[model samples]
Target: MAIQSSKTVSACLQWVIIPTGSHICMAEFFKTSVTWVVDFHYEGRPRRWFKAFGPHDDPFQQMTDTLKDLYGDRAKLASVRKATDEEELQYLRGEEPKNSYCPTGR
Candidate 1:
């Protein structure tokens, strides 16, 4: 489910469940006025895509809130931080970063 805000900008939230029983979520911010283009793996075995949109200011919070709302108490928000360039690259390449924040409480 995507949450649309009353702004001209939007953000994307993506997540993947790893084999270690941890989930990694990434939030990418962008403006609605500009054409945002992202090319990466979207379909394959053991891979899924979930997207949500919110205000451009704080995508991490929006993502966390959306998860919590969807999963209720079962949702546990772990560390949230900005993904470095290398981390983003690794994610684009279908690799989880070593420094990724995984949901450990689940």
Candidate 2:
């Protein structure tokens, strides 16, 4: 009876269906209530940043070189992992640094 009544009352809601891909995977599902947001984060730092040599001494490579030149071995030519946000904040705030030769924190 409820199903019959529901069929009698037509809903004016609009729906869109796009079947472009071969298999329909629900991996990116987040729209049951209408707010769309997608931000991807890596569990570890990108492997490209850890390389000893990068893209022919370009900006990233040059920056790494500059740090090594300025701070030597303490400047992290090869880091075990990405610095956490809090650690980076401490560096910016002069709360702590691995090396004392980096001039005044201000």
User: Candidate 1 regions off by >4 Å?
Assistant: 1-55, 97-106
The CA root-mean-square deviation of candidate 1, after full C-alpha superposition on the true structure, stands at 18.5
**lDDT for each residue of candidate 1 in 1-106, tens digit (9 for 90 to 100):** 3343444434443433233212122223333311211111212112222232434545456656765676566554444455556655555565642322332211
C-alpha local distance difference test of each model: 0.38, 0.35
* Model 2, global lDDT: 0.35
* Model 2 weakest lDDT span, ten residues long: 32-41
